[model samples]
Target: MTATSSPLFRPLQLGPLNLPSRIVMAPMTRARSSQPGDVPNALMAQYYAQRASAGLIVTEASQVSRQGQGYSFTPGIYSDAQVEGWRRVTEAVHAEGGRIVLQLWHVGRMSHASFHADGLPVAPSAIAPQAQVWVAGDDGVGRMVDSPVPRALSVPDIAAVVGDFRRAAANAMRAGFDGVEIHGANGYLIDQFLRTTSNQRTDAYTGATLEGRTRFALEVAAAVASEAGAERTGMRLAPFITQRGMDCPEIIPTILHLARQLDATGLAYLHLVEADWADAPQIPESFRAALRQAYQGRLIVAGGYDATRASQVLSDGFADLVAFGRPFIANPDLPRRLAHGLPLAAFDPKALFGGAAQGYSDYAPYEAVAEATA
Candidate 1:
């Protein structure tokens, strides 16, 4: 497919599965699940089924355990009830002939005790942070004041968390997703372990040597891939982000090396989150080349991408697939809208995070417009 010409309608192979198109719906938290740690609801299922026309759908970052949650009314993939809830979602999506992958997540230090079911949050370092998690109480919604001091993860704790991810993958399969995406980006647990600023511990995990610091993620990739099969597992990373003090001058090489280690894992794809935050460093082309070489499997790039820009990227040959986030929120049938150049309904920026179903699932689709015109 050429850059100037639109080839998005053509089918492509993402790992072992064939995608009808290259467009993917990147996971975004809607915070509308039935409860803080409840299973997904029929409303959530309807939301995904409505957008099933995309080549593939990567669900919102769902915590592997209650302790991993960072917000209220988000879903989990650990418990039996949660698994059953997701089964409903997967059934709906599959009925429409769409493939979906559940994004596995652990918030790490980006959480508060109020949000934590276990009452303490794990971080790479013990240094208190200056951020608060959004929360709600009896009266109404509000951000929790006075952030919880984080507890540095012990070596044993690190092993336990890995087990949690394994369990989550198992649950996801039971729920009948096409695959799972490991959330290693956007200041989450994996990102925290990858950065030196957050991981000040003297353990092998916070390896003083470059290779040591990359060990945790490497092990995680192998573990999840071992259980889920390489084709059924993918990873997401933001190498340039430093929100909770994630620093690494050798960031590019570090991530590439991590991908190299996972080369044997036979994973489906690697999704890179490249946000255009002014303070955040931009990824050089060299890094993309190295990533292309390291990951012999499918590659996906996301964050702040539009059709023209994403089309250029596809032509550049660095990424085989691209995922869209906020666009999917406004246009449930985003691929159709992109193909036909339909006007997009504006998303209520305020209602995006946590809200009722008004903004979440009320957006109309192209067929509705057709019926209206008829």
Candidate 2:
């Protein structure tokens, strides 16, 4: 199908914002925030502004607090400087008529001890993810290091973290974000709390019952929605992701139950992060149908989607929007390129993280590239 007639180019009403297209720019951590304070900067602003053609842009995950950090150079939403820094990004995107939302994050046990003051990451339980996080040394060299056993969060600590999420939502609004997305996916803090394999606690947020296992995630959603307004708040979930020792047989049901609650609360949308790597498990069609039935709000599906697959999914009524990750990194005008069936550019792997502007904002739009080639 041609660009103008494609379903992917259709307009969407996402919450209070009227999106011009159904293409979304999924959140991907580039880890290029200003050092020392882990704050967003002008370079990041330039990077996001370049991709303004997306119907919606979910900014890279920003930790709600210091304890929520997992990798070096990831920005945070807990400080004044960070809020101001994000304002520049929102302003730049707005100038180009792009809509953007901030993704609030807490990495849980997917972290190195170097990020914590007490040398311990906190999770729903003390279990280790058996994964590695990228930590940079004093000399600015980064390497993957094993994640250590985390200290389980206390009841009080859970309340504190929920409060942090609330504050982060308020901070996001102050920073001029069009909305906020709670990062409940990818085996992060909320994901850790939802799965029995990671959350073995016997407390109210235990992994035994579906209600208990979903408590933390629900609380965070309610709190953030309250602060950011339910119409402007969204949450990302990874129901089928099994990496980082997060394989749980009950995760699918747990997510569906949580979706019902979010639906009742009038959440703006639920973003599902499907497995994208080679030979990754395919998300079942039954699950998608069930999710669509359970939640009445808009749904966005991301991972390994090209124009054909994206349009098919939308035609099947499984998802209202499709988010592209790596494609947006290399093609600033990703929506236009996809709509026009233009060839995509490959992103530089070396400069994917902790870099200045070489691979971050140096990518040219198709018009510029065509001009250069000519």
- Among these predictions, the greatest lDDT belongs to 2
Worst 10 residues of 1 by lDDT: 1-10
* Model 1: CA > 4 A from native: 1-4, 140-146, 278-282, 367-374
CA lDDT of each prediction against the hidden true structure? 0.82, 0.95
| Root-mean-square deviation of candidate 2 | 0.7
Please give the RMSD to the true structure for each candidate, in Å.
Answer: 2.3, 0.7
Residues 242-315, model 1: lDDT tens digits: 55556566666778888887776677788998966656556688888889889898888887787877777877
**Residue pairs in steric clash, candidate 2?**
none
lDDT of 2 by residue, 1-374 (tens): 98878889999999899999999999999999997899999999999999989999999999999999999999999999999999999999999999999999999999988999899999999999989988888989778899999999999999999999999999999999999999999999999999999999998998999999999999999999989999999999999899999999999999999999999999999999999989999889999999999999999999999999999999999999999999998899888888778999999988887878999899999999999999
Clashes of each: 2, 0
- lDDT, candidate 2, at 50: 90
